[model samples]
Target: MARTLKEATLTTRNARAKLGEGLHWRGIDADTHLGYRKGKRGGVWLVRWRVAEGHYHRDKLGAADDAITEGTLDFNAAVRAARERVEAVRREERAKADGVVHSVRSAVLAYSEMRDARLRERTGSEALRTASSSALERYVTGRVAGGNMEAREAAPIADVPLHDLTEAQLSEWRDALPPTLKASTRRHISADLRAALNMAYRLHRTKLPASFPMTVTEGLHISRKASAEAGEATARENQILPDSKIGEIITAARDVDAAGSWGGDLYRMIIVLAATGARFSQVARLTVRDVQADRSRLMVPASRKGQGSKPEATPVPVGADVLAALAPAIRGRAGGDLLLTRPKMMREPGQLKWVAVGQRPWGMAARLVEPWAEIRKAANLADDVVPYALRHSSIVRGIRAGLPLRLVAALHDTSIAMIERHYGRWIADGLDDLAAAAVVPLVPA
Candidate 1:
């Protein structure tokens, strides 16, 4: 027996309530249907369309007009809205099949592809491109680790048609983001999405529908209060170590390598990190070719800056000790090998070995914490000290040594504004020079 969906009366509040709790769908045409799902509070409208033979896609339209509420639709309105939605879906399906885009997911994917292509051309390393993939998966197309815990059942917003996207829908997505994520992390994800959507709109404007919400500018950020809180937390957390203490940590790392615990892998990496002041991720992405051992410089990759092969990568001049530590690894490995690798043997075994026999890239940050703790304890440093202290201390050292803020920013792959914002306290180290210059030829007066 075949269940036939007849034309049902969903006009009045009484009529909808009688249709019952489950979805009551009525065929509007051979290919489209208008649906109403009864609920305790109110009923809701839904629409489904057969884009292919025997294959249908469904989407919620809005609330059914059981009451006089904003956006609640009457029978006629529901019919119009449902047909519009069905048409939008069918149009996008045709366009998508033909390699065109009108939906949010399609726009985001297009932007990502272009961005990765640019990154590949600029850096000649796929690390940035790889990072973009991870971000898109974690935050956009997929969900985060601790996604909106309450509403875990919400449909992924990735497929929301740009024609259907509204401020409320986007804001709903933002509010539904994982509450556990740091404000800064949330902000970054939001900014990345906004940038992607905006980029797509600029590059493919003609492909977009009239209802395509210009760019993703509405409600796509953490609040200013949240941003301020994150800034305060960053300032509180990042501790700067002096050169003497950094030197002690290096020596302690060497001792750990001698004990066969780290096998000199971490030891060499620490040297490069302390010497170059690059982010852990940036340094970890370094290839054997990046090591200009002959010139005692390392071509550290800048993080997501400088498009199109222009930003020179600014070879960082390192000390003799850094060169000496690197020479052993540089001598044997090919130019494409990772400059740093996870150490072999047991740092305490019984764990699954992530590092392969031939390929050993740096593992997770949490795993590195234990190894760094050993060196921190050995150097008699505070428990709070971590690998990032190397970068912070280096930045601080440059500031205290009266290096121009611009130069320091360029060297660290950060902005001058960041230096001024986070490490402004250290910039006062130039007060003595300022005071001396202020005195000038006052004796003549």
Candidate 2:
């Protein structure tokens, strides 16, 4: 039902008095209404307009009282505001239906919200969240921040309209990144931006300009050349420790353990990592139950890297020495107990005796690489030597020991192509043995 006001009666206070809470007076059309409501601040004028079929939108025009800082709305002003609002609503509805005029910020935010919801529902790894968030923070939000740091300032293109965004503008922004950022990092950030735009296009079903360039491939290629010229494009090689160096590191770890400054568990962890070639994350999450009774193999649980769409357990074969090294930590522990646990400071007791705490569900594990710095320094290893070096050392040693390429890849949960790419030369060093055993000189015979 529509309530229409007579133009003659609207000029009196009597007509104004009739406009009470939940009362609406019809304006030029049935779909548009000038309404009144009693609120905490005396009275408020509201305009309700139907932008589409059965879809009504409302907006507060102003307060009825002058004392309300928002300003007083007389009948004429209210009607004018209502008409304007109606026009605005129609424009917005049209834009939404036509998939035009959405800002880049709006689309990116929509994509981010959708991505976060999916991650939460699927229990996705933090790395995926980090990659997406990095793109949003660095480019969309215009913040020059990533790697778990606070956002400092906005990027140049942060506020640019999505439809108006151009490849030239993006190339300029990409070039402005800190020279210290690696080529790989630049490529990753670019890839993330492209992914966000693709997701936005798919999810919003919006018609982006055909000229819109989502990928920054050309810009990245140019940047890579620039980086090479600046000597910043060199690929980092993994540090592989020799047997003698490993022995020295182990000796230093044992010395540190004997001093009781840290626990013996640290050395055991190093031994296991060196022997099994498992990632730090996988090894850190190990429990007694993960180890097989035969002590020849251990099950590496599906982590972010190994776990794809469908996750399952991966079994890694271990040497006898690796089993012996892990024995001290797992001895007398329940099957479910963590293999590696770090002592924590629970409370300070009278300055002399500090209460020590063990493992809790959310407590810090001995997974960080910082603790190994001292050991590395003491062992006179390279400054760049990290915990992952042990895994590389294992892989290289296995290849040198004439382990089949496929077997080595299986052992390390990696691909044959990856092994060939990084450790191919080392793998080639052992090819002579294969030649000596399998082939004979045809010319001499």
Best by TM-score: 1
lDDT of 2: 0.65
Clashing residue pairs in candidate 2 (N, C-alpha, C atoms within 3 angstroms): 142-155
Pairs that collide in candidate 1 are none
Error of 1 at 311 (Å): 2.0
How high a TM-score does candidate 1 get?
A: 0.62
> Compared with the true structure, what per-residue lDDT tens digits does model 1 show for residues 344-399?
44333676744324435674444477778888889998787778888898888888
What does candidate 2's lDDT look like per residue over 240-298, in tens digits? 77888888888888786666444667677677677778777567667888888495888
Q: What TM-score does model 2 achieve against the real structure?
A: 0.59
Q: Top model by lDDT, which number?
A: 1
C-alpha lDDT of all candidate models, in order: 0.73, 0.65
